[model samples]
Target chain A: EPEVTQTPSHQVTQMGQEVILRCVPISNHLYFYWYRQILGQKVEFLVSFYNNEISEKSEIFDDQFSVERPDGSNFTLKIRSTKLEDSAMYFCASTKGVSGGSSYEQYFGPGTRLTVT
Target chain B: AQSVTQPDIHITVSEGASLELRCNYSYGATPYLFWYVQSPGQGLQLLLKYFSGDTLVQGIKGFEAEFKRSQSSFNLRKPSVHWSDAAEYFCAVEDRGSTLGRLYFGRGTQLTVWP
Candidate 1:
């Protein structure tokens, strides 16, 4: 089965530095999403992307954060300034959106563990 | 706001024993429910989902779930669990019934299967 893939399984960066997390969603998927999980905590949604634009975002996705589909296959999340609170497991997910039908399931990647010091 | 509750934080079961993890949700409308499992150092894996259906949904890895609308609960069950089934399980809800919507996830239940 095809699955979403994320690069740099672990990332360590200094506070105030910029960090970019990369992901390659399933080839045929149309809707992409970003989520984060604090250590030993529930997973929280960050943003959802479709058609190269943001469909929805949470308060955690503030000014310092942005997402890009630079290529047809790559979806990237960038944090302009990393903070201690930013350390978490960032997961990339995708799904084949149902067309005119009800809906389909979303798949998640292994996630990139971001550590800010 | 939509929220999910997983009452059990941890559970231990002997190999080949039956298991059930509880989950409840607070959503305004017809909810879309999903069960995901995460092994150590791995991402979340989908087990099953409940949409408009017969209420009893079967999923991979010998897992199943029942959606009880009256109780606002979607609990996961395994008739016989293996050692490999030890992992963290999460129940999530998507109120919008689509991937475009956000998924509110429960805190998760950690299952430990003893050999």
Candidate 2:
């Protein structure tokens, strides 16, 4: 089965440095999403992207965070200034939207583990 | 506020034993429920989901879940589990109000299957 794929399975960066996490969602999928899981914490939604624009974002997705679909296949999340608290496992997911009466089942990538020091 | 609760933090079951992972949700409207599994070094994988009609929903890998609206619960079950079934399981509820479906996930339950 076709699946979402994320690059740099593990990322380590300095506290003040910028970091970009890359994902290639399933081809033919229309809606993409970003979610993060702090160690021992619940997975939290970060942002959702559709039609090259953000549909919704959470408080955690503040000024430092931004998402881009630079190409037809790539979805990227960039953090301008990373903090210690920014360290977490980031997952990318995509789904065929409610359009055409498709069920909203999000297919997830293996995730990129971000470690800020 | 929409929230998902997985009451069990961890569970251990012998191979071939039946298993059930509990999940509860607090949502205002008709809720969209889902169960996901994460193996070590892997991302969350969809196990099953509950949208509407026929409270009992069957999913991949011999797993199933029941959505009980009255109880506000969507619990995952496996009649007989294998060692490979050991993984972290998460329960989530979809936000209906958002144009893009946003998911609220639980803390997750870690399953350890003994050989």
Candidate lDDT values, in order: 0.92, 0.94
**Number of the predicted model whose TM-score against the real structure is largest:** 2
Q: Write the per-residue lDDT of candidate 1 for residues A31-103, one digit (tens) a residue.
A: 9999999987889999999999998899999999999999999999999999999999999999896522345
Q: Write the per-residue lDDT of candidate 2 for residues A1-117, one digit (tens) a residue.
A: 898999899999999999999999999999999999999999999999999999999999999999999999999999999999999999999998682133668989999999999
TM-score (chain B) of candidate 1: 0.96
Q: In model 1 chain A, which range of ten residues has the least summed lDDT?
A: A97-106
Model 2 lDDT tens row, B1-115: 9999999999999999999999999999989989999999777898988888889999999999999999999999999999999999999999989888899999999999999
Docking class of 1: medium
Off by more than 4 A, model 1: A99-103, B97-99
DockQ scores for all the models shown?
0.59, 0.72
Residue A5 in candidate 1, Cα distance off native in Å = 0.6
lDDT of 1 by residue, B1-115 (tens): 7999999999999999999999999998888899999998777898988878689999999999999999999999999999999999999998585448678899999999999
In terms of docking quality, how is candidate 2 classified?
Answer: medium
